[model samples]
Target: MKKPAKILTTAMIMLFSLVQMPLTQAAMITTGEAIQAQQRNIDRDNLLSMLQKDELRAQLAAYGVDAQAAAERISHMTDAEIAMLNDHLDEMPAGESFLSVIGLIVVVLVVTDLIGATDVFPFIRPVS
Candidate 1:
């Protein structure tokens, strides 16, 4: 009986010590920062979704731009770079010229298009 009690007590003490240890290292995260990061991810995803469009993908293929490389590049870009690229995209209006826009978006965002802003283009609908 004493031997069983000693073994049980030792097990309980070990379990108690384990429980007393920190479960996980807590990291500080502000709500605003989290929301901003999430928004960036969504925006990046939207741009990637745009790339997946058949017309755009073919256009990219025609231009010899590798779609996979472009996506990988987005992951390494800084927040400011992403914001800048997104701002450019927001300026573009989806229209009959969507193919051209897609080409330019891929080219411009990836630093290969080297063209002027699209907002000034006659076809682009003003952000309303």
Candidate 2:
């Protein structure tokens, strides 16, 4: 190739390479948001831990939800969902029925799906 053509080809290749590279940017977050995020993560971990406990898992099985499948499903919950659930856990009164809480969570997930926040189940119709 001629000199000008060679330079143009090189320039085009460089431009395309730059376009193909990913760009990263960081935005400032409020302290409250940061705390909320951390709490959400903690909540998610605690919930997953509870689900994985053998005794609790056996109860979940009795409720007709497979332990592993329930754990996997919980893994897909959004941060807000997790935080809301965590708040519920934190506020649970002593001696309240624990199995009901798990069942209520399943119901809430189904309701969340109906509200279009998630598409985890196929049987429910999501609200528009």
**Best candidate, TM-score:** 2
TM-scores of the candidates are 0.54, 0.64
Clashes of each: 1, 0
Distance from true location, Cα of 56 in model 1, Å = 0.7
Angstrom error of the Cα, residue 23, model 2: value is 4.2
What CA RMSD would you report for each candidate? 11.5, 4.3
Model 1 pairs whose backbones collide: 107-113
Task: Summarize candidate 2's per-residue lDDT along 36-108 as a digit string, tens digits.
Answer: 7887777888888887677777777676666676677678888877777777776878565366667766777
lDDT of 1 by residue, 2-86 (tens): 9999999999999999999987888999999899999999888876777667877787677666666556666656777678777
Shift of residue 64 alpha carbon in model 2, Å: 0.7
Q: Best candidate, lDDT-wise?
A: 2
Model 1 clash tally? 1
